[model samples]
Target: MSDWKTLFHKDQFRFIDHTNSIEPVTALDAFAVDDALALSVEKGASPTTMRIWTHDQTVVLGIPDARLPFIKEGVSWLNQQGYQAVVRNSGGLAVVLDKGVMNITLLFADGNKIGIHEGYQMMVGFIQELFADYTDQIKAFEVKGSYCPGDYDLSIDGKKFAGISQRRVKNGVAVQIYLSIEADNQARAKLIESFYKLGLQGEKSKFAYPTVEPNTMEALATLLNKPLTIDFVKNRIREKLTDLTKELQQNDLTAIEKEMYQKRKQQMIVRNKKALGDLFHE
Candidate 1:
């Protein structure tokens, strides 16, 4: 209800689903792509865009996370667990990425009209609408002891299943959410807990990292008692867009966006190198 109508009542909604990409789309690439789309919207080259993406077996770290005292050991441990590590181009601590997690980005050109909390609230409303049929009990609040905890973490009955973060480029804003569709949320939390344990080593850091508890998180399938799949959620997102907007169409990146994507992708690479040193540089 907090200005969500202004955020979502667009004449055109461009839908892009990258959930089935055959190529290895790392979390870094996903960030770059979102920035590209956001800039495209800002420049009036694209309409409001909704993108769905997924990555397999990756751990996305925040900039603060890269500065952890024992980061190399933590990254090595993630590698041993068959998870690739990369720092994201935004805020928040470490978060898990796997096949069962679906990431959604809603990009809109707001031209400084939207505040940061407004963007987060818009995503909260959109997600509640997305799953309104199942239950109207979704709540947005900081789920303490959960990975990437924030004031806008989305949860059901006190257990978090999703987290929202926002990034802005020029006049455009990208509101991103990661929904644990159907997988081992506790196992994912355990991995993050170990990562933090190795990275922090009980040091008193400037930033207060989360003390992840496996019980603080739950997958949507478990939370809703419904067999939810990424594919199913992807379709539902498309359907919801169609129902909410004047027009909804599956879209590919324009030439301008593609060019911007390449530049932003390079920027992401450089950022990762600076934050991660030789571990990210190829």
Candidate 2:
């Protein structure tokens, strides 16, 4: 059990609470953060940041998702449900994001001492401490039926509530996770399963997508038998981070960050255009 203090250390985490708005930093916001932090680390302008963001009714697809045999059909299905679809610049498959879902990205600069497991463990440890009051027996294991299933999927008992993905750029690593603190997890799962069906249309393609099983998906509320919300999870993060370190500075995108963000935003636009072609052709 690594201590939270050791993981975050005594540095200032450029934090942002999305519960309050400022230019609407969506999940794609981190595509910029990743680039900015990677540069900041190279120039030594700032310390690591733990940015928190939340998006409502958005379908974040993975690169593989964009390559789905019938991606146009799948994306169209999502749009019909009033869910905006965008392929992220990170790994992993399709994931459902909503107000009830909160995303946490820990931007860190490792001078080569931190390995992959170490960075991931820090988050796992933080979640354990955050939800300490709920259950102490949480485990990090791959949940097969999970949408973005990974080895470090956060689970209590047998159901998953969160999944983490890592992207390393230069010396900085942005570890991002989408936690379903609250919401109808089964409904979310069903959405992606439908997406796979529509995206593939039973057509044999070179790419393979997960056959999502809704039964394997469960929200933190269902796992803990308590009504939960993103606010609850945000509060948990604040308490843990604040308690671990003497200073807690929750911040928004600074001028420097904004400058860098704009560039990455354009990059995202180009990437999206490639990933999601004009559905008008559909």
Candidate 3:
């Protein structure tokens, strides 16, 4: 585990908590925000940032997912199920997002300085700190049957509760994680399972999708056997980061960042349009 103290040895840390905001910030917008903040940090105009955001009933898909055999049918199924699906600009497969799930993006100044696993270890260490009181058994290993399965999947015992992925823009890196704070994790997993079933339809493909098992994934509330809400987890993040930094202040985007965000967001929209084909306009 990389030491948070060593990785983030700054005097000040910028905080942006969008947990309770009523603004129309989509998951697409969140990626743009990270990109803009990352570039600002790379230019030495902004401090390393900790951003918390959540989207209501959205399924964030990866690039490969859009290439599934019958992705259009899968996407239509998602729409019929009342979930808005969008492809993320980051590396990962499909992940569920809702009020019950909390996303944390730790933006640092440079990507080249850190190895990929080191970036993941930073988040793993931070999460271990967050749940220090509850348990120390949180493990990081690939959970094979879990959605977005990766080596950095944070688990307790055998069930996965969170997964980490990293994205780099220019010299900046955003280490992002989606923590399943509450609700039925199996329900979320089942959605993805069905998506692959419809999309793949037993057809042969170059890429192999996971044979999702809902039991392999769980929420913090279920895994920890405690009432863990998104608000509660947000507080834990703030408390832990506050203890490590000399100063932690909430900061919004600057005018330049906002402009950059608009451009990135448009790019995302265009990418989605291209990737989803007819599904994009719908």
Candidate 4:
């Protein structure tokens, strides 16, 4: 694994924690926030930033997922099961996000010079270091039967606990990850499995959806055999950031970023409407 410090060495790191905010911020807002942060970092208005966010019941889908044969029915099923579905502006298949799932995004400048694989490696290295005390068995490889399977899937003992995705805006890159810290991961996998089943309806499509096996996914609390909570993981992240950089400062969105967020959020709204059509709702 690449040393995280070598990849992300900086004098200061800005931290934004929205995990326990009283204000309601949906997954749509979360993605928009990342876009605004990316632009800010790219323009040198913001430093390297580490943001933590979580949402309630939401299924974030990829562009191709919206094209599934019976997508309307699939989305209806998700709604029936008390989950709202939205297509994200990033690259990846459908992923389940709930209160139990903690999302972390690292945004920094110089995206033009960073190779795609290096962006992924930076996240992998950071995750490994975060849990180094518990175990050194975290490995990054494609977990074939898991939702949003990718080359940067974080797993232990053959069971995946997290997945990573990347989004680049102008000269900045945001490496995003969803960690199944403490929840029924099997149930989460099963939810996606049923979604695909309904969406495909036994019909063939160019995109090959994974044959999701619920047993292939496990939560970090279960995999580590420790009672882990979102708060615990957040603290670990803060400690790691402090150790990696000379200073860690808590910052809020500036006026420019807030304005950018509104524009990005509107784009997200329009994108979802076009992608989901009648199925899209606030």
Which one wins on lDDT?
A: 4
Please list all clashing residue pairs in model 2, or write none if there are none: 70-199
**For model 1, how does the per-residue alpha-carbon lDDT over 1-282 read when each residue is reduced to its tens digit?**
366856557777789988997522688888999999999999888988889999999998999999999999999899999998988876788999999999999899874987888888888999999999999999999999899999999999999999988889999999989999997999999999999999999899998889999999999999999999999999899888888888786877878888889899999899998998866733
TM-score of every prediction relative to native? 0.97, 0.92, 0.97, 0.97
| Per-residue C-alpha lDDT of model 4 across residues 1-282, encoded as one tens digit per residue | 245566457777799998987533789888999999999999989889999999989999999999999999999999999999988988999999998899999998888888888888888888999999999999999998999889999999989999999999998899999999997999999999999999999999999888899999999999999999999999999988888887788978999999999999999999999999999997
Superposed Cα deviation of residue 162, candidate 1 (Å): 0.5
List the pairs of residues colliding in candidate 3. Answer: none
Lowest lDDT 10-mer window, candidate 3?
A: 1-10
lDDT of 3: 0.88
Predicted structure 4, TM vs. truth: 0.97
Q: Model 4's lDDT to the true fold?
A: 0.91
Q: Give me the displacement of residue 186 in model 1, in angstroms.
A: 0.5
Q: What tens-digit string does per-residue lDDT give for candidate 3 at 1-282? A: 257666656788888898887643788888888888888888888888889999988999999999999999999999899999888899999999998999999988767777777878888888898898999999999998999999999999889989998998888989999999897999999999999999999999999788899999999898889998988888888888888888887878889988988898899899899889778742
Clashes of each: 0, 1, 0, 0
- Candidate 1 residue spans exceeding 4 A from truth: none
Off by over 4 Å in 2: 1-4, 280-282
